[model samples]
Target: MLGQGLVDVFFEDGLNWEADLLEDTRFVMVETTAYFEAYRHVLKGLQEIEEGQFPFEKYIIACENEVSPPKYLRNRRTVQFDLRPLVDENIVIREDEALRRQRRIVNYQFSAESRCAESVEILNLRSWPRPDQLHLDQSQYEALQTALTKEFVVTQGPPGTGKTYVGLKIVKALLHNASIWNSGHQSPMLIVCYTNHALDQFLEGIDSFFKGNIIRVGGRAGEDMAKHSLKVKKQALRKLQDMRQIAGVRFNCTKSMMEVKLEIERSGAQMEASEREILHEDMLRPFMDNCYDQMTCVELPQQQEIPSMMVEWLGLEQMLGETQVAVQQGREDDNLHDKQEDEIALSKRICNASVRLSTVTTKFVNPTIVLTTMPVHESSLLTSSNTTSVECHGQQ
Candidate 1:
């Protein structure tokens, strides 16, 4: 009643509202949007019901008693009652109008015509391949066979009879025979359960063996499946994109720096051969020795240094030394960046993030298997898909 939007006279914490009896007051029941979302699936399921096909008749109940009954009055007394037409047409038309509006937009995701012919045509279970790994009893095998050969199946048993075990086997069988059911495209499989615990157990089992795209829609999943939730996947995808972009920008900067370095080297090489020789032989010796050993050094050993040309050359060499250090640092940074990039790529591949989604169309864009509860199944966020083929495996 809380999440489904029903009128309640008490607070959520089991407390009743108190009003001043001496003052004028009014009680109001405000409508919320929860009912609309909760009942949207009903609208979709009832799409085939046409006008005048509503199963229930509209009637108004009236109490004809003029005197008030005692607080202790029980079933011992009978009161006069009358059933009449709902003359206030708004009462009846409101629900009808809401349903009409919902019906206009409710597009059915599943249809009977899309079912596989082989699913209904197959009569013998011996025609299907049986894996050596599956160890199922007669009942479990029969249930799995029914699931593989039929469009819909319900496997019911007590707690310890391996209902979920058979469901997992059916999923495995479907994976093995996806081409027959999905027309060569390994489209998504939707598994709807009645509880979060059941959804978690089913998802963990699927994650253990099935290595394709899978996502848990609800937040109450166990820790093992938390990282695979749609919200977490989107966040991880965004972080991956951001890191890649930053790495790209840094790479461009490193490339520009290397280009500038190459230009400097080219300029140094363009000097006349004799001039280069002089700078190498004459200038370098005096500068390294810090003495007037060469004619380029104008003054005494301790007083003045090399010539202005030599001095300028030494300054350029110092600048080049600093640039080399920067280049080395950039290279080191790039190495670290590459390592981080590799780690991210590995994690993405493991999480199926590589094929997961780069944009809105990317998530669930591949052959996906979604495990969720009944409440989440009704949620538009989980059931929304444009994929043409959907294979469902049910267990109860």
Candidate 2:
């Protein structure tokens, strides 16, 4: 039985299936949550298409061309892929609702008022680093610029034309302008790749530029990325905070013991209770002060003055920055150790370009800008499917 669902299996020719299953045999099943979500999204998209309510009205497919097969095949035909967009007036696209929905998405995604003209102007006015200093060649620069300014952009390039490189630049630019473009709401960006390796590589690249919260939904991350993973980071931070809390409790316990002693002194033999209580408190003060000095970790400010949760958050933020720096340093060391001469030279070139870019794009690469605007507490990104080109999950 799989969960609550059951199925019956039949053996052929009286074969003993149990005999084939050894005592040490094991079965591993993977969750299909991502696949199921994709499937459900595809069904919704198809339903919308059937109802003539699909978006992207301009790209609707028209008629298909069929041709007979060659002499080698008997009574066979194939559909030619010379497909064209439907432009007939008879085929009307219902776009009013789609437009409204798109507007809402734009507003939420940008955290702005959805002023396209203003946004375009903002993109245009950006003082990008000098083309000569950027790592990208002319074509790459043009592609990156077009992607930044246009509402819809499709970049086509040959294999070695730095598509991924330009993509990383675009991500950086968008993250930098997250607050300015959205005015106040900084929507998270979603990146989808075909394989886990590609995703890990892309995320690692993001980590190089931005030191903020990152939650990787799926698994099979590389060993080097363990500290960067969401689960590991959270656990490490929580463990540190727990230690601090325990220390605080121990210190509080010491104080409480002193208070109990003073109370006992006040309840002394009826003659000199008040004077004894005063003497007891005075004597305990020095020892309590020593205890406070020893338990320095617990000498936190009062909660009313400085909340414990805020302290934990500040500690986490500082650690995250240090972690990113360490990760970057480790990467640099690894490159120095393992890189060939050509790779080392190329890396130097990229570093020079990055330094130049930083002069003009410092605001965009600032971690504070991205973290303050982007709601990391929410589900940041929803990746699409691998098999088909259909957009999958929406913002949660």
- Residue ranges of candidate 2 with Cα displaced over 4 Å: 1-122, 125-130, 182-186, 237-255, 268-396
Instruction: Write candidate 1's Cα lDDT for 1-396 as tens digits.
Output: 878965445443455545433435556765675667655667676886775564431221232223222222223332221100011111111112354345432122323322222232234445433322235577776786666544435589989998987887666545534434553343577887767788998988877655566778766888988977899989989999999999999999999999999988865774655464444444345346645445344454464333344544455645655766899999999999999999998997776632321111223445874433332232133224553323333332
Local accuracy of candidate 2 as per-residue lDDT tens digits, 168-234: 7777655544433443344556787778798888888777765555667567887756667778877
Error of 1 at 192 (Å): 1.7
What candidate 1 gets wrong by more than 4 Å, as runs, is: 1-123, 128-134, 179-186, 271-396
lDDT of 2: 0.52
**Highest TM-score model number:** 1
Tell me the alpha-carbon RMSD of every candidate.
Answer: 39.8, 42.2
Q: What lDDT does each candidate get?
A: 0.54, 0.52
